[model samples]
Target chain A: MKHPPLLQAKNLKYSFNETGTSTHVLNDVSIELFPGEITSIVGPSGCGKSTLLYLLGLLDRPDSGEISLNEKDVLKCDDKKRTILRNHKLGFVFQFHFLIKELSVLDNVALPMRKAGKSKTASYEKARDVLGKLGLLDKSNRFPHKLSGGEQQRVAIARAIINSPSLILADEPTGNLDTENSKKVHSVLSKLAIEENISVLIVTHNLELAQSCDRVIKMRDGRIIE
Target chain B: MAMSLIGIVLGIAFFVITQAQTSGFEAFFIRTILGTNGAIKISDRFQDMDGTVSKVSKDGNFQFFFRSREEAQYTEGIRFPDEIRNALASYQDITGISEVLEGTAELAGSSRSFPVIFQGIRYHDHSQVSELNNQLIAGAIVDFAKDPMSILVGNRIAERLMLKIGDRIVMKGGTGTLQLRIAGVFETGVSQIDKKRIYIHLSTARQFKGERFAGSFFQLALDNPDKAPELAAQIQYHLGHRSVSWQEREKVWLDVFKALRISSAITVSSILLLSGLGIFNVFAIMVIEKTRDIAILRSMGFSRFDASAVFLWQGLIILFLGVLLGSFFGFLSTYFISEIPLRIRGIFSTDSFVVNWDVFHYLWAISLASVFVVIATWVPARRAGKIQPAKIIRETL
Candidate 1:
């Protein structure tokens, strides 16, 4: 049986003000996200791919739109409710690793669980379990800076899934990696969709990364063209 | 972090040391004041036409006459000694009560002569209320009690009169002159006391003044000196004697000591402010530099309040450690300084630098530093919280 879309955006619009001049960033964009699938938004720079991802991730509010997560109409929620949604239901991975330099790899992974009000022991145990699955159990105690670029990216992925969110959003997550590390990160994201039944939405410029995803939504001039 | 920690440590140390030094001075000053008079004094001069204490005086002391302000009118001392003594004895906090007669007289030795304030009290009762017995640098305070003609001269008075123990001096009073032997020499660490005060027997003092052999003021010792004001109020209500505490009688030194206190307070406040500004600047820069980190946390489901709380907790932890370190070093320095024999000779009558090593001072220092840290970290923490996760993620990508 086919499942309904896990996330849906309808007629989403967003604009930016630069030096008193208004510029349209995302113009009347619509998209749907499905469970147990990997999706990619491929577009040139400044084409609103990241803007769409941000709006879907609940990091930014669209100027005018309807965003529904599990058909709950998230756009109507307050800031605190949106934050709670992000904390418990959605995970985000940025282009850069952006791990807290002060925390250890394990602590960084467990941060989300802790923020979700998990106990310290439970958070660390789950953090270790996830790190081990990512082949990073040994590096769990190491600081972020002590890890290699690929290792840090893997750690970031571990942090994203620690809270077991329903959807994981990525904005060029593998942009800073080498070809080999890029493939490793892509393999991890693909495995998460297949093995964990997690729905993922990635914004990227890599054609290979887009083609490997279950669905590809191409964008140009702030609108999804294909 | 290191810079902010250093700033906090230094600022806290300065505050703690200032408190120790100021408190030391105030304690020594109070001790000197209370050494001559006890915590509370009830003068007999406020007796009315019916030979009774009518009311409390405006100055917190007994007033004999409410006549012209310009004219010098002497108030008769406490008339009802038995009744007042019985009233004082009823209170549990009243440790000791001594009847004293205080008047001005001149001491003439073979070589020199000087004016002095003579205080006569019964040795048993006076010794219980005053530290005179412990302050004798030469001879014995008990010898003065044994011999009615014996007197205890202050260190400075002894120097000026070129007198010593066993030497006789002619004391010229208002009505007559009498020869009295110096039984003891005391140094009270108060210039005024050492230079101008002479202790003798009440009977001898009365003989020199002629009739009405009544004590001037009843000095009261308390179990707890801090409770003097409350005890004095109770004493006034019950005994009908105008009670004066040490704080009331030593009003002259209040301004000088108050200036010291205010300067110390300002010094502490300024140091905290300057150090806080330094820390605030440091944290402000850290927040700006770590804007990306803040964004990462926010995007990972942390709220604005959580974002700021991280930095706020960091600052508080640093401040706590800094305050602990500062208190340790500050206490050592104050201890060392207190050991140095300041010998502020002939002024305030202290031998060594007095430093208050009270635990409350340390706690106060830490508490003050923590308050400043909270204030200093507030703006930067809030700024950190306001960082837009989407903006950072978008810009970085």
Candidate 2:
């Protein structure tokens, strides 16, 4: 029994316009991620790895493309529907933790569930459970500012996975961390993909981390070479 | 947030205070006018007249002629006052009626003399129809009634002639002069009336004028002064006499007061609008400062409407707190103003500032301030919603 690809992007093209100059970022790129697989997209600087990640995350519109998430074509969806899809079917982790400083670890994790129309009690309950699994339940009541860099990134991961999303998109997830913290984050991502059967796609410049993934794709000048 | 809250508070406070001040002035003016003259007055003056004449010939051939004729003959004063009084007495709204003879005379005191408009009234009936008894600042109406030759001089008249209670004065009318003693001094707070008016017994006016002298008009008091216009019209139609409501008689002054109210409203509205602009500035700065946070929320699947609603809720919270604190401060301000004693003596006189505490003023302040707040917050909130997550994320990267 084989699993279907959780996310598929075909012939995606995107460009950036700056001061009347257009720079083509993603040029006719295509990719697919299978469920329960951790895939790494490794590239040099200015190679548009982050651009492709953002397009797959539904955070930006491509100049032209087809994106089918969970077997549903999503490019034709309006902004509101796209936002709903992002909330229900996808999760995101960025280089920076991006935790709201004012919110506690519990609240930061609970936000997605709350946005998904879950009741406050249910959201907090699930947040605590996720934080427990991430080994940060004791610090759930503490604000993000008080957390270590690795701890904050783990909290961001908890927040992303709180809604049981089918896919997770990570851009430079461990770029800002040290060796030990990066390994810890990498182990957490691999475990989430294997144990929870979630499709995890990471865009990073760390070839070591890419080599550790179940599948690795190399990109140069916006085109995947391997 | 503090700056925005302050703007809303100040705007709402100023609005409530302005409303209270205007209401106070308007109430004072209406009180003075209604007290000086009852709610309605019936006289023989011709208010509405139709002089048009129509003629029709059998064959539709007729010569039309137009001519100006002498004024139609009418009685000097309200005709059959007793009959009209009896007819109006059955009305539930008409509280009291008094016959008064108004005449002009020169009143001489020991030091000086001044021309005066004197109202000769039956003291008992007049007390029911007017606030004359309550207007007395010195002596008593009882004393004036006890002495047949006694007169009640207005405060301004007393001040001008240097007369006090029990002082000897002589009133010289068109026909004769009568020596009288001042029994009381009253102030109606109307400069014109207080400066030139006096009150005496109706019998004294009849004796001075002639045996055929009748009351000049019938003053009627009503249960509700606001209903004067409607009742006045009805009375005029029923009795065929000119009936003037207090509002109609003081039309010019009322119009002036109305204009003052409108101007004050505009002034306060402008102040609130400026305060709203302050709110706009603060929120705009907040949106800029929180750009990263907005981007984070947008990336977390918060809809554009949710982004906009975040700021709108901030505005609403500010509005709620502002109205609460502003109303409290507004009440305190009006209370303090009313307690400050300062004599104002021009067209209207008061020993202290008048402040009218009306719930409507607070409601109006809240309503007007909310409008301004909505307008103020909407711009920044919309900007917050329109923020592109990709752009912000890319910039941060």
Candidate 3:
């Protein structure tokens, strides 16, 4: 028997209004992400790939669409409920790492669990375990600025997965890294998807990275082309 | 942030110091007045007599008539002085009660003569209510009492007349003139009292004024001066005599103090308001600078309320620290200012600055500053919470 999709979106639409001018960013886009599968959305600039990722992450509301996570409709959820869902059920990785510069690597990873009402000791213990798996246990006490590009991206990954979400969304996760760092981040993400049985979605312009995913969906002019 | 905190500290400190100074001045003036006149003075001066018009028209018709006005007779003094004193002495609240005879007299020195207001009192009974014994600069109350023919003169009166403790002076009253010896010289610090007043024995005043004149008034001191007005009212109601509290006697000065209080409040509020504005501006800038952090926090599942509480707590922490430091420095400043010696001799006299160390001033400073601080913090905190994560994320990323 086939497993059900972990996240589903149908006929999603979005737009941006700038000084009385409205531009449609996404048009009738739909996709299904299955558990333990790594999927990539590849498109050019202004092609709505990031917009789709944000929509799936529930960071922004689609103008018209149906979004369901684990067979439950999320469109009807209030802001507080949506935040809980984001903290517990979904994780996000951005291109810039976006780690708080003031916090140590361990504290950065522990933040999500802390927000989810976990005790500080439990959160830190879990954060240490994740860091040890990522080979960053020794660097956990150092601030984000002290880490290399690839290490910072890995810390961002650790933070993303700290709450053990069912799906992970990455928007150009390795866009700012060199060839070696990019490969390292790519391998870590693939390992996370298979080892944790969580859905992983990546939006990237790097064709090689897209080709490495289990499946790739190409987009043009706000609609899927493949 | 430092500047804003300093502003809060200075604002609260200034408020505290101003309150202490104002309260200090009021307390000093009240103590002087109470020491001289006691807390409550009972006399017939304020009593209302029956009208001179004894008859009115019976019918409600237009009538024109002329009637000769009769000479109005007034009560000479408090009626039944001993009864009033004895009745007041039984009250637990009344600490001391003394009868006083006040009249104008002429003091003729060997080389000079001056008009003076003389107060006559039984020394033993008067000492319980008045601070006259403590105020004597020369001779003692016991010595003054030992000689009934001797009188205690004010410092200014003795100085002007070039008299000493053994100098003999002639006192001319309404009825006759008598020769008297100067027993002591006292300084009450009040310029008017020291310059134009003298103390004579109550029996001598009666003899000097003749048998027709009773004592001028009875003065009573209470355990709590603040309750004088209420007790004065009660006494007047039961005894059929008019009673005036020290506060009522100094109504004009008290009114001036009230105005001072209002102006001080306005001034302190303005300072605090300016400080609050400084805090508001600092927080506003902070919100702008931490835009990216806010976006990240929101994206990390921090609710808007949590986001706002971050800034609100920051503002409140600053307020807390500022108030604590400000109160400490305010108390220190008032103490140092009060220690500075000053010689101000006038209607109101003091040798040093009077600083009131009431805890309420500190509490008032905190309460007033908190109002402005909370309002100042809430605006920017709310603004920080309202920042949209999607918009900020899009712009920054």
Candidate 4:
């Protein structure tokens, strides 16, 4: 039996205009992320790697594109419908580990679950189990600011996966970490794709991190080269 | 947040203090006047007489008195005093009725002559309606009622003339002059009453005015003073005399008090409004500082409404806390301020500042705070909600 990729984007295009000067950011970019595969997008700065990920994660709109999650077209969804799809099907990890300073680590992780209409107990128990898997259960009560950069990034990963989404989209998730912390975050994302059969797509400048992934999409200017 | 909360607290405290002081002044004045005037009075421009008392040319106080009989005589004021009194006597709402003979007279002391208002009454009937008897500081209350020539003098009047009880003074009125002895001196705390008013027997006042069966007005005290206006109207319709409620007689003072009320309300509301502006600034800065956090939450599936709600809750929580603390401080300030002794003398007298500790003032303070905060919070919350996660997320990338 043959099956389609878990997430796919075809001929995605986006542009930004500055005072009547048009700059094309993404051009005819097509890519597929399969289940149980850790895929990485490698590019230089301003290479549209993050833009393509944003379009795939439904965080942004493309000038023209065909995007599908489990064979359902996502490009046609409205802001509200796109948000629901993002909540239920797509998880995101930004570079900064943008955990809310006002909330404790456990609350930050459980926020997505709570937003998904899960019970408080169910969300907290799930969040606690995930934090324990990351060896961070004991530190769940601490605020994000008190934690080191690597721990905060791991907490961000826990938050991303708490909704149990099929696809995890991480944009340079460990770009700010030292080698040790970067290895830690890379191992967590690889484990999420392999152990949980989740489709992981990462955009990063780390060549080793990209090469260790199941697939790597290289890009220049606006179009994917491989 | 602290600054805004402090603003609210100070505003409410000032409001509480001002409201209490204004109300205290008004109450003190009204109470002092009511002690002398009763709750309602029925007065007629024309004197009660035989035949007809006609308006000669109707200006201010111009009137023509005509007697039909060859041997002419003048009767009392108020066309049907007996009928009016008899009609009002049985009403359950009416507590007491005193026939009043009020006119200005000259008191010629041996050394000084002072102009005074002579208020004549049947002592027992007047005592039931007023606090005059209780205000008698010296001499006997009986002398003013029992002896035709005996009068109750105000303390200020007696002091000005250097006259004491049993001192004979000549009272000159429109009719004639007569020798009257001061029997009592009263102090009402209010300077106007103590300086310009004197009480005498109704018969003596009539004799001094050279009119028998004459009454200037009837002072009626009701069991419920709040019903004065309605009762006054009813009594006026029945007796065909002009009636005035206690509130009506003090309309000028009430107008001035209303202005004070408006000014106080403006003061409180403006302070609350400024507090709200402070809250708005605080929340706006928080939203801007946490722009990336808001973006991350939205990326984590928090909808715009949810993002907005976070700030809304923050604002509401601050408002609730501020109002709670403000109310406590406001009440405490009122208590402390009311404890201060203030002896104020004007149209009325007060030994201390009067304050109304009505719970409604607290409720009003809270409501005002809520209104301002909600308005203050909405703008920042809406701005926070409108922030596109993609814009911030892309910037961070």
Candidate 5:
């Protein structure tokens, strides 16, 4: 049986204008994100993996490309609508958790729902369910700073999936973690993708992490090489 | 939110109390003056007019008899109720309401004699209307109702004559030279009134002026001192003529107080404005420092509005504290300065205490200043919102 990708990036291009020069960061980048699969985009340090993640999360506008989320072009939506779509349909995990230190762990998990204007009770219940799934129910009220590296990454993962998004894009989510913590994060991500039928595209430098993904796509200047 | 609310209430308490005290004191002064004196007054050009504007005005002192028919008619003119009758019968406020008298007096020392115009006031009524309680320094007020012949001298009069209380002074009036004893002396702080005041009983004053029913001015003590202006208004209405108020009678002093009020306003505004600017600077620095926190909030699904709100909250908190602390310091400042003797090297002195504790002026000053602070905070808070979350996250990380 054949199925369409949950997200399709076709002819994705980006550039930064630097004093009358077009600094091309990405060119003709294309990939497929399918449900229950982990795709790793591996490259050198400044090869625009994070830029690609920013584009995928709709945090930045591409110079030219098509980002189809669930078969609809994301670039066509208004800012407010785009934000709503981002909160509802796409999950993002950054290198740093970027977790609001002031908010509780449960509140961090419930953030997307709160952004989506859900009631407090519904957001809290949804937050608890996701936290419990991540085996963090006991620590829901604790703040992110109170948690360790691997546990915080898991909490970040819980936060990412709290709104039941179709695709999760992690920009080196475990980049700061040690080998042991990174493996622990990888297992949890793999379990989440398989059991929840969610797709994940991770940008990582570690060849071992890439090898463990369902499919590994290598990039040098921006073009994907499978 | 609850904790934040507690902070706000505490801040408002510090705000409102200082505001009220300043306001209450201003009210007290304005009340004190307006109580003893009326708010407004109308007087004739020539202050010594009897009922009509007669060109040949009798001097402030004279003497004589009135026609019996005129006296009988004059006595029949006035009527009163029991409450009013009882107060007037006892002559509590009025030592005596009498007549204006003119005299030439000799200075006891320096032997310089000059013609002086004097009015024999019911001395008790003089104190009731004069606000002598606020007198800077005083000897004794005269007992005119008890001793019809005794007299009180005005501050300027006493100064010029070089006389104090318990001085026997001889004055040549229209009929003869009458010897009167000086009972007490008072200063009204107004130049004109303090220059030429002389008091005796209402009957003696009429006797000195020489007309029983003829008087230079109407001198009646109010039934109640607090209700003087109201009663004055009623009497003026009954008389259906242009009448004079004591405030108009003492315009120079009123003008002085008015000037005092204006200067106080200017001083308070300058101080509050400077304090507000200092607070605004504090808030500006605070927002700049919290830029990263605001960016994190924006990234955490908070809209630009929420981020701005967070900054605004920080501003409001700081301003609330500043207003409180500033007012607290302002009070302690005023009191501390007051505590140190006001007449420091004779350079500074005040009516009562620091700018006479004006409430409305200070509150208006503070509110105007704080509004500027609030507006000033907006620039920084909006700048905070403009900070990009990803850029901040990248930069901070």
Candidate 6:
């Protein structure tokens, strides 16, 4: 049975204006994300894959496009609502493992929950359990710099899911990881997407990683190569 | 490198000096006013108003005016001259005692109008007359005498009136009028006192008032200048017998200190605002420099508010370090300038710029300087909130 799409984008267009000359970044790109599945977005360099992801994540708006989370038309949602959706419904992982180094691992993981108004003890306990599941329970109190590259990426994974987001959007998360770390991360992502029935989108040029996903969407010159 | 060090050094020094200036005045006011007057005053402040006061015994001989004789003994570390001497040896903190004396027109020369402070003084021990002289801009101090009419004129008044010693100046008091001769002209460093205040003999003060009266309510010097309220309390306890420390009895020196403080506060705040703004600019730039870090936090589920809080916290941490260090050196600078290794008085009694550990003062200066830190911290905190995590992440990736 094909249920409603968990993440939807329609006819998104974006351009960057430099000194009055328009550089068309994303032209008529559209994609849909569904629950209980992984969609790997494979694109050539500068193909606007990250740009589309940003728009879908409500991190930026396009020249003309509509995005919806579940059945809610999120393009019409106010800024506060967008922030709420981003904070609760959407979890993001970057290639750089952009964990705030100043914060302890548990704090970085618990951050979204804290923003969602979770009580301190509950947020801490939830983050701790997630860290434990990610095998970072012993490293919870350690700062990000102290963790190995693999452990740090794992911490980032625990952080994204700690808020129990319905959609996880990772932009080349394993791009900076070695093969072993990348495989370890893929296992974490695939297992969480399947077990929690959460929608997952990974943007990458790594063919092996892309080929392993349930479906691969290839892009060239900012349009889907259907 | 020199400019940076100068900025930091001068910034710290200016902050400390200006802060010390304001702090000193505030400290002095509390000491002089709070000590001289009670911690809080309950007085018929308005001239014709029945304000909150005078619940004491209403014996016709008992007025609201009184002083604590115990202060003198407690401070002298000696028993007051005898209880008889104590009874006669009063402690006075009078503003000015004016009397009208109707005397013979026996002066054969000049009859000039002179402003005189006819302090109804009985002895030197009680009337801290030297304090009046401490305010002298010029001229010598006169000894208190038993005779009537002989007095001292401030230098400015003497110069303005063009009259020296041996010239006669007449004054009218609240009671009878008095005629006094300028046996000597004394200048208290205070130009106001040098030009205006006149010291008249106590006998003449009584002669003008039509009775033989001793001023138990004259200007007094406290044992502990810092604990004036304690002195006032002891006065009420011991001398419920004599006088009151109302607004009327404060000396010119106290007012001078107050005016100095108000002006210093305004001046220091302006200077601090500029320096603080510089500090703020630096810190804001620091936040901007750490733009990537801030964006990473925001992108990692931290809201704009959380990012701002982190910056503000960092700025506060910087302020804590700078201010704590500045205060230590500010204090050290004050002490160093005071000792000057050469006994030199820099601009504005630079002596006060350096001081021993004064809690009331150090705390005030440090806190005032911290307000700038808050403003400095606030700018950067706000800048942190304006950061776009999405934009930053896109740029980095």
Query: What would the per-residue lDDT of candidate 1 be over residues A1-226, giving only the tens digit for each residue?
Result: 8888899999999999889998998999999999889999998999999999999999999999899999899999988899899989898887888898999999999999999999999999999999999999999999999999999999999999998888999889889999899999999999998888899999898999899999999999999999
DockQ of 4: 0.63
lDDT tens string, model 3, B143-245?
A: 7898888899989999999989888999987789989989999988888999999998998888887753455898888899998876776676566566778
Candidate 6: segments with Cα more than 4 A from true spot:
B1-278, B316-371
Worst 10 residues of 3 chain B by lDDT: B62-71
Candidate 2 lDDT over residue span B49-71, tens digit each: 32211233558764322223145
Which model scores highest in DockQ? Answer: 1
| Model-by-model DockQ, in order | 0.73, 0.62, 0.57, 0.63, 0.24, 0.29
Ranking by TM-score: 3, 2, 1, 4, 5, 6
What lDDT does the true structure give each of the candidates?
Answer: 0.85, 0.86, 0.87, 0.84, 0.63, 0.65
Q: Candidate 6, residues B193-283: lDDT per residue as tens digits?
A: 4555565655555566553332323333444444444444444444332223433345465566567666765665565566677767776
3 or 4: which has the higher TM-score? 3
Per-residue CA lDDT of model 5 for B1-397, tens digit only, reads: 2333233333333343444444444444444444333332222122222433222225864222212222111221112222333433453443323223333333233365545556655555445444544442445543444677776666677778787666777766655656787777755444554665565665665566565433334444444444444444443333422334454444565565566556555554444445445555665786677777665455445666666676587667766665565556666555554454332111111344333454554466457555655676677768776777666655665
Candidate 1 vs candidate 6: the lDDT winner is 1
Off by over 4 Å in 1: A17-24, A43-45, A76-89, A97-165, A173-192, A206-213, B44-95, B211-215, B223-243
Deviation (Å) of A114 in candidate 2: 3.6
The residue-level lDDT of candidate 4 at B317 comes to 87
List model 6's recovered fraction of native interface contacts, to 2 decimals: 0.38
The collision pairs in model 2 are none
Candidate 4 lDDT over A15-88, as tens digits, reads 98789998999999999889989999998999999988888988888999899989999888888888888888
Q: What is the docking quality class of candidate 2?
A: medium
Sort order, lDDT high to low: 3, 2, 1, 4, 6, 5
**How do all models score by TM-score?**
0.83, 0.84, 0.87, 0.82, 0.64, 0.60
RMSD of 5: 10.6
Candidate 1 lDDT over residue span B1-397, tens digit each:
6776877787778777888888888878888778767999987443332332234467787533222223333355777777888878889998999988888889999977899999887999998898988789999876888999999998999988888899989999678899999999998877888999999898888777664435478998989988887677567545555677787677777677778877887777677777788888888998989888888888888899998997799888888888888988898889888888877754367668888778887787788788889988999999988999899867776
